[model samples]
Target: MTVTELLDRAHALGSDPRNTNFAGGNASAKGVERDPVTGGDVELMWVKGSGGDLGTLTAEGLAVLRLDRLRAMADTYPGVEREDEMVAAFDFCLHGKGGAAPSIDTAMHGLVDAVHVDHLHPDSGIAIATAQDGPELTARIFGDRVLWVSWRRPGFQLGLDIAALKEANPQAIGCVLGGHGITAWGETSQECQANSLEIIRTAARYIEEHGRPEPFGPVIHEPLDEVARRERAAALFPLVRGLCSTDVRQVGHYTDSPEVLDFLSRAEHPRLAALGTSCPDHFLRTKVAPLVVDLPPEASLEEVTERLRVLHAAYREEYAAYYARHAVESSPAMRGADPAIVLVPGVGMFSFGKDKQTARVAGEFYVNAINVMRGAEAVSVYAPIPESEKFRIEYWELEEAKLRRLPRPKPLAGRVALVTGGGSGIGAATARRLAAEGACVVVADRDLGSAEKVAAELGARAHRPSDVAVAAAVDVTSEEQVVAAVRQAVLAFGGLDLVVNNAGLSLSRALLETTVDDWNLQHDVMARGSFLVSREAARVLLAQDLGGDIVYISSKNAVFAGPNNVAYGAAKADQAHQVRLLAAELGAHGIRVNGVNPDGVVRGSGIFASGWGANRAAVYGVEEEKLGEFYAQRTLLKREVLPEHIAAAVFALTGGDLSLTTGLHIPVDAGVAAAFLR
Candidate 1:
C-alpha cells in the first residue's frame, strides 16, 4: 500500500475515541525508496513521530528510516539502560526527513516483517492486556490468533523482546503487549486496520459474554440543576486543587456528568479504581491511581474541605512509601507528583494538571480506564500491570522527557479571571490580555456563540501548557445565571482571582421620548447587573480566602452628563456608587473593588457595534463614521479612548502597584476635565 493510503487508514483508526485519544498511539507503513548515492532501491519503514496525532497523521509527521540500518542497529543495540544511545542510533539512521524524531517503538516496528503495522491503546484491548490473568485469558479467547508479551518497561529491551517473539512465532497475526496495548499488522494498510479493529471488537464481544454482570457500576444520583451543580463544583474544586498542588500552583478541571456520577456512586469505587490504569501508557498522564476523598452526603463545605486535606495528606504519605519501597540506593529519589485524579464519594471526580488541557486529558483517560476495569472485573478478576512494572514506566527517562520539553509558564500563572461581556469590546480585549499573561480566563457573555468564539481564540494563544479559556452563557442581571457564571469560573480553573463586571446596555433617547422599558433595561444591565455579578464573584473569592480584584466597567457618563442620555448616564452613576460601597464591605476580605470610567470609546466596542454609535451620532447631526474623530478632537489630549486603553486601566487597578488603592475610579478618557475623578 502507498504511504498516503497508510496515513489515511491510520487517521481512520484514530478517529474513534474508544481507540485512541488526542496525540496518542502510533502507526507505520513499509515502502521501498531509491538510494540518493547508489540510485538503487532500498527498503525503508515510515513510522509516526513524537507529538504526532494518528488522527491527523501526515507524510511530514512520519519518520522514514532505512530498514537494513534499523535492523542492524537492533542486532547490536545497547541495553535498555542506555536510552540516550538508543535515541542517537535512531537519529543517525534517518532516510526520509531528518528533523522529526520517530516513535520510541520504531525499533519494534522495524523488526516486524509485515508491510503495514499499527499500534493502538484501544480501551477494550487494554482491559484484557493489562489484566493480571491477561496472558492466560487472552490465550483462552484468541487462542493462537495472538501472542501475549509480558510487561516490560518500554525501550530497547521491549523492542528486543518483540523481535524475539516474532522470530519464535512468525505466523502470529499480532500480539497483545501485557499491561500496555496491542499491535496488529498485515501486508496491506487496509488489512492492518481491519485486523486491529477485529481484535478490539472481538475482545469487546468476549467481555460482554464472559465479563462481570450488569448493575455493578454506580448509579447516577438524582440530578442537580445547572446552577446547583456548578455551585458545588466551584466550592469544592479549589480545596481539592490546593491540596493536590503541594505548594506549587495547579489548575484543576472537574467533571460530574450523569455517567461519571453514577460511577462514583458505586460502593467499591475506591478499590475498583485503585487497581491501577487500564493500560500502562495511561500511567504517564493519570499516574497509577486516583486519590479518593470520602464525602458524606450531609457534609458541609467546611467539612468537605477539611476532609479533603486529611485524605490528600494520606495519599501523599502512601505515595512516598510506595516510592521508597521501589527505589534502589543508587537511584536518585524520584519526586512524587500529586495524584492526577481525585474521587469525591457521593459527588464526582476531579483531575489536576499543570494546565487545563492536561487536566482534561487526564480526566478523559481516567474515565476510560474506569470503564475498562469494570468490564474486566465482570468477566474475571481485574488485575493491572504489577506495581514494579508501573514504577519503572513512571520513572522512565524517555517518559520524563515529555514534561521537560514544555515551555516555562508566564506570569499570572495559576490565577483565574472571569470577564463579563467578554465576547467583544474592552472585556474581550481584557480576556485575551489576561490569558497572554498566563491566567486561565472564563469568557462569560449574554451570547453563547460569541463567548465560545472568544474563548476558542484565547485558548489557542494560552502561554501556559495547561492554561485554558472557557466560555459561559450568562446574563449578569439574572441572579441564577450570575452566580452560575462565578461557579463556572471556579470549577474551570480551580478558583476565581479577578472579576471584570463589564457588561452594559445603553438607552440614548431623551427623557421626553424614553419609555419605562428603556429606563429599566439600562439600569437592569449597567446598575443591577454589575451589582449581582460583583456580589456573587465576591462570595467565591471570600470562600477561596484569597485576595482578589473586582473591576467594574463604569462609563464617563457617570461623571459627565450628555444630552438625550439620561437613562444610560443615571444607571452608570448608580453603578459607580455601588462600587464604592462594595469596596467598603469586601475590603476586609482582601477583595479590592474598583471602577474604570471610559469616555468616547466609539470604536471596537460592543456598545457601538450594536448600533448605539449610529443613534448617538444622528442625535448630534454628524455622520456615524466621524463620531470617533469628533469625540477624540473634543478631548483635551485629542486621542480616541480605545478598548485596549480601557483594558490597561482595568489591569492597573487589579495589579500589584494598586494593591493599596481602592474605592476609586480610573478614567480612560484622554484628559476630559468633566470626566475626571472628583
Candidate 2:
C-alpha cells in the first residue's frame, strides 16, 4: 500500500462507524518474498500491534516484520500475539522486527499473504452485523468480493480462516469476519489498509442509509408493583440463562442507552425481535432478541407459560434459520443449547449470554437496536437484517471468542447519581467531580438557576430545583416530596445509584437567648429534612435492587459542639445519628449511607454564609472574617476549607469508591475537627 493509500485508509477507518471507538485493533501490509541480507526469505509485513486505537491510527503504530516467521510461529502458538512474541524473542527474526509486540491478527495477516491488512471495530459494521439479516446483508453488499466467515473466537481460527481464503482467492483484497471485525490485505501494505478502510466505511455508510428511523412515541413508564417486579425478575433470569447458557446480569446496560430507554418506554413494544443486539460481537455474549413477556394482569401461570413456549419455539426456529444462512457449514459447533429469549412479564426484554458481563452487553445492544428500529419504523417501516442472517454472524465461532476480551476503566460508567443542593457550593462541586469520573449526575437544589447552572456546567441530563427542608418547599422533610424527587430522578435517568444529601440549614444563638422556635426551626431543616430524605432514598434504593450510596452533609458541630450554637449543633448531631441508622437499615439492601462533617466551608455563599456567620459571631463574639481566620489557624493545613474540599469528601463517600465506609463521618474542615486548641 502507498503512503497516500495508508493515510486515506486511516482517515476512512476513523470516520467509519464500524471502527468507531476502535481502541485495540491492528492493520498491516507486506511485500512479495525477497532474498534477505542473510540469504533467507525477507518478506516484511507491516502490522498494527498493541496499544493502538484504530480510530486514530498513524504510520508509527504499524510494525514491519517477517511474514514467513510470523506465520510459522502461528503454527506453533494458537494465537497471533503469542506467535509474534515467539518471533520477537528469537535473534534470527530480528532483521525487520520492531520493539513493539504485534497485534493478535499478525499471524492471520501473514497467512492471508495480502499486501495490506486492516482491522477495526466500526460502529456501523457492528450495527449491520448485529442485525437479524446480517449474513444476507453481508452477502448482498460484498458477495464474492468479501468472504463472510462465521463468528469465531479470535486467534487460531482467525489465522486458519485467512489461510483458507488466501488459497481460494490468492489475490482477495479483504475478508469481513462476522461479529469480530474486518481484515483486508493487498499487494502492498497501503493498498490493503485502504481496502480495509473502504470496506468498513462503505459498510457503515450502507447501514446508515438503511438504518432504523427515530422512535416516535414515549419510552418510559411507571415501574411495576413490588410483587410483579420480583416475579418478573425471577422468571426472566432462568429463561435468559437457559437461552444464552450464561449467567445473566439481570439488569442490562440498556438503562444507560437512550435508544433502549425509548424502546422500553414505548406503550406497545413491536418488532422487538428484529432489533437484534447492539453490536454483532455481542451475539456470542447475548442472543439476538430478549424474550418479551407481555402478560396481562389477569393472565394465569398456565397462560404465561403457553405464551412463553410459543415465543421460545419461534425464537429457536429463527435462530436455526439464521445460522443455516450465515454459517458456512451445517455441522458448526454450537456454543450452548439453542439460544432462548427471556420472557420479562410486563417489564421488557433482555438477551442472555454465558456470563453476567456478556448478558449485560447483549441486553444493551438489543435495547439500542430496538430503539433504532422503532425510530426507523416511525419514519417508515423498520427493516433490520433478518433473523437468519444475524444468527450466522452471532454464532460464528471467531466472533464469539472476541466477547471474552474486556474493556478498561470499569466501575463508574453509566452509573446514576443524585446530588442535592448541587446548584452551588459543595453540592455543585461534588456533582461536577462525579460527572467527570463517569457517573451521570442529577443536580437538585432549591435555586433553579443554581441547579441549572451546575447541570449546564457539568453537562448533566438531570437537573431539578428541590428544596430539601420544607415538607412543602424542598419536602425533604416530607415523605411525599422525597418520594416524588427520587421517582423523578429515576424516571428521568432510568435508575438511582448514588445520593449525596448535602442539603441542610444552620442557625446560631446563645443557649439562654435561643428560643424554642429557633431550635425547632433549625431542627426542621437539618435534622428532619435529613431523616426524611434518607428514609425516602432508602425505600427507592431497595426497590431498584441496585445497591446505592448516600452521603449526608453533617457538620463538625455534630461532634465538636460549638459554643452558643446549641440549636445547629443539636440538629447536626441528629443528622449524624440518622446516617448511622439509615446505614444499619439499608446495609442488608447493599445501600451504603455515610456523613461528611465539614467544620467550616468558607466558599459556600448565601444561606450557608448567613447561618455559619450568625453562629460564629454569636458564639465567639468575633467577626466572620476573624472566625474564618481562627478556624483556618486551628487546622493542621492552615488552609480555609473551600466548598470544593467539602464536596470532595461527600463525593468520595457516595461514589462507592469507598465501599466499606458507610456509617462513618469524614471531616473536611481542613483538620479543624481534629484540633483541640483554639
**What local distance difference test score does each model get?**
0.79, 0.59
lDDT score at residue 601, model 2, on the 0-100 scale:
72
For model 1, name the residue pairs that clash.
211-378, 211-379, 212-378, 212-379, 355-466, 356-466
Among these predictions, the greatest lDDT belongs to 1
Candidate 2 lDDT at 613 equals 72
Give the TM-score (vs. native) of candidate 2. 0.60
| Window of ten residues with lowest summed lDDT in model 2 | 463-472
Model 2 Cα lDDT, one tens digit per residue, 1-678: 443465566666654433544343566556545565567557766555555555566666665666666666645664543432443333344235354445445557667655666666554455444444556777777766766766654555567777787679754566666545566666654566567666777775665566544334454364456566444443333333333322222222223234443454465554554454434434434466655656543466567656766776676676666555666664355544344335343454444332223334455445445534543344334444456555655654434434444354334554567777777777777777877665666787766677777667665232112211111124455667666666555433434567887776666667998999889887887787777777766655665565778888888888886578788888888988888888888889788888888876765644457566766655666776666676788788898887778767766776556987778888777776442323
Could you give candidate 1's per-residue lDDT for residues 1-678 as a string of tens digits?
578887898889988977777667788888887898899999988899887878877788889888888888766776666754686688767885453577678877887778888888888888788666888988987888788998776666777777677668877778888877888888888888888888888888888888756434544344345566566667787667667777565678788866567667666666777776847557777888888766654467788788878878888888887787787764445666578888775567788777777777788788778767766676766778778777776765666675577678776677788999999988889888888777788999999999999889986643333357889999987999997787777777777788898998776898899999999998999899988988887776776666788998998899897899999999999989988998999899888989999987888788987888988898988899999988898889999889889888877886567899988898888988877776
Q: How close is candidate 1 to the true structure, as a TM-score?
A: 0.86
**TM-score of each candidate structure, all chains considered together:** 0.86, 0.60
